[model samples]
Target: MSERTLLVIGAGGHGKAVAEAALLSGEWQRIAFADDRWPALCETFGWPVVSDVAGLAALEIQVAGAIAAVGNNAVREQWVEAIRAAGLPLITVVHPRACVSAAATIGEGSAIMALAMVGVDAAIGEGAIVNASATVDHDVSLGDFAHLGVGVHLAGGVVVGARAWLQAGCSAGYRVAVADGVICAPGTVLVVD
Candidate 1:
């Protein structure tokens, strides 16, 4: 199959990371960006910022796939849904240094960053971010658009709800349940109930 083109939605730090990952993978030939904040001025990682999401429809070019790189879960969720509704393909990205089990399942538009580990049967939901050095243990499930900050750890069978953000260095106990929209502060320790 021919290589696909990627349009990264968002032009912030996380978006730059995603663009770099895509470029390093060499799976896609063309990488462009879309953001509400226009005039990206210069390209990121050698890829130009094409247009804003509002202008996506007027491009007249085919975008093989797209990924929402927004950091906020709510915004990420919205953009992912918008792209999906537009009939555009959503793609997932895994950093070269990340380790993912064969039994693990990562949904579309999700990103597993450098040094992250996804264990057996762990299900990462669509548009979720498993940030650098984060760990999702066996049988854990992360709901759509969830964000796991750097060094965060989810023990076996843990369930993280939609749009949740587990901040950096935080660790949740085995079988812990984090409710939707929950924001665990940095360095927090969530004990199992």
Candidate 2:
């Protein structure tokens, strides 16, 4: 059987992390990048920029899956939808060092970074990010396009709403519901009931 080709849909730092996760996953044979600003055949992140939307049709034959690595919640959502419309399966990338429970369900386009822990039955939504060393306890729910920055911790039963951003080192108590589109400051603590 041939190996799967994955397209990394950004050309930035997060995109590099996502590509590295894909590599760590060990399922993708070849990796390519696509960005709005890159030329059709330029090299970035040690990979080729196949093309943005304009070249998806031509590149589709070589790309079996894609992940939108954009860090911005709104742009990530848009890229997720665009990749769907183009009929490419969005890949969920979990780094090799991450500990994800078997009962956990991670949605497509999500990235579980290195050393992150996703506990039992945790539900991570599409395009969500669990950055390096973050902890998502059992029964936690991360909504679509939500981001948990590096070292953020969510106690069991925590619910992070759609497009919410928890900055680095933030921690939330159990049963907390972070509102949608909320931009939490770094190191913030929420003891919501």
Candidate 3:
């Protein structure tokens, strides 16, 4: 069977991580990037930047699946919508090095990056980005479009609301609830009240 190419949405830093994760997954033969932000920058990290998903449709390229690697929750959600609207399947992209439990459920358009860990029964929501080396503990519930930045760690039973952005290296205590639209500063630690 011929290897399939994957269209990675978002050509930004987050997009670069997603493309790296895709490469680690070994699921695609080739990786292509689409970004609405940099329409003129034709190449990213030595990979071709073929415009956004809508542009991909215009180019009529065959993509087996896709994932949005946008960091901002709103932009990530928008990319998801655009990818779907462009008729590309939004896939769950995970790095081979990430330790994801079989019981854990990763939603569509979610990317689990290198060395990230998704514990048992954890639920990662749609368009969520589990950045490099981050940890989502067992039984955690992550709402739609949540972004756990690099090295962020969530204790067991933590509930992250939709569109929340937990900054890099932040640590949330067990059972803590981070509400939607919360943008945590780096290295902040949350303890159970």
lDDT of each: 0.89, 0.90, 0.87
Summarize candidate 1's per-residue lDDT along 1-193 as a digit string, tens digits. 7767799999889998887777677777778888887664546667778777777666556788999998899899889887877678899988888899999999999999999999999999989999999999999999989999999999999999999999999999999999999999999999876
What candidate 1 gets wrong by more than 4 Å, as runs, is 1-3, 40-42
Question: Which RMSD values do the candidates have, in order?
Answer: 1.6, 1.6, 1.3
List, residue by residue over 85-154, the lDDT tens digit for candidate 2: 8888888999999999999999988999999999999999989999999999999999999999999999
lDDT of 3: 0.87
- Which pairs of residues collide in candidate 1? none
TM-score versus the correct structure, for each prediction:
0.93, 0.94, 0.95
Error of 1 at 119 (Å): 0.3
TM-score-sorted candidate list, best first = 3, 2, 1
Off by over 4 Å in 3: 37-39, 53-56
- Superposition TM-score, candidate 3 onto the true structure: 0.95
